[model samples]
Target: MSKLLNDDVKEMLTNILKDMVDEVYVKVYVDTLTCETCTETHQLMDEISELSDKIHYDLVETHGDKTVGDKYGITMYPTMVVLDKNQEDKGIRFNGIPAGHEINSLLAALVDMSGKPLDLDDATIEAIKAIDTETNIKVFITLSCPHCPGAVTKAHRIAMLNPYVKAEMVEAQTFHEFSAKYNVSSVPKIVINDTHDFVGNQPMEVFLDTIREAA
Candidate 1:
């Protein structure tokens, strides 16, 4: 089969990952029997791992490795769990194929897992650090959406900063049931704790305030 990422893309990834200070392991959970994109997602992650020593990946079959899947709360195929250098799962999840603009979100996740600080304002970071209540954030997105990455990155950063936050980037097309349930007609729909939700990309301060209010 052909490579998932081209030479230029590989080179770009290499450069971006070269500054990584810690190791990042991407654990991909897949159910080969039901997932059409499992092979492609595996191949893509494998090629990405080759770009940097700091990056590595493991493919876990959902049925065959139920314990591991269960440990990560992976109920869907093509779910990526980004672990920090110590192999700690901070609840950074990606449900569905990370292609197109979502690829940028994938890269940002790697950077975050590598212990690199997010580029948010100091005040924003402090506010996130102050969040003591558990917050589960799901940002529904489609691969083709140009504006999806920004929202995904922000949510992931929030998860990285606060231990109370668990963020997921859900591909709406792959998980149609969730899209229907949440009424996600548009992309980048932010769902917080299944109680509060909103559509479109929100500013960092506004997003933080929203979570605080929901909590």
Candidate 2:
């Protein structure tokens, strides 16, 4: 009845978010010159911050700040790390956006973890397992784009690890017609059940959330 990320979930996030005494820091690690995804990555972060005001964004260019990268142990551009108030340790790290549904799930997990230090109960696990059993999600991707490979690998890895997940590769240049038909204007355009779609690489939690919703 509601969108994948509903008002209730948003409210829950806001509540837990309000309870936090420390600031949540989001660091965007990128290479200013060589990184092809820098511009779009900034745009995506902009969108994310617009959705929630709890995030503090800091753009760090790889070449410009060696000490900063060393401090964070960042070796990859377009890497997003969620740090707690202290900024000493990493709380949640997403390699790529899994999906909208997956992001919401991770947010819920973060909130739950922050509010109460524990894991999901058996019943909840069973429900999650049931959801996995009933849901099927697939992603068609390519291997050429630097970003494409990581996304493709993540999708495949997730599919291999989860029964309901599936990912296929379509050579972008070879299958240009099919790609065009899907309105895939860029690399790694994930399509869910021929219904939902989003472009670019996403955080892992986000990707999982998207798959969860599709399921």
Task: Put down candidate 2 lDDT per residue, 10-79, tens digits, no spaces.
Answer: 5755665564343566677767675555655566555545445656678767665556677655544555
TM-score of candidate 1 relative to the true fold: 0.95
lDDT of 1 by residue, 53-154 (tens): 899888887765556687878887889999999999888999999899999999889987897877878888899899999999999999999999989989
The segments of candidate 1 whose C-alpha lies over 4 angstroms from its true place after superposition are 64-68
Q: How big is the positional error of residue 17 in model 1, measured in Å on the Cα after superposition?
A: 1.4
Most accurate candidate by lDDT: 1
* Worst window of 10 by summed lDDT in candidate 1: 61-70
lDDT of every predicted structure (CA atoms):
0.88, 0.51
Q: In model 2, what is the error at residue 146, expressed in angstroms? A: 21
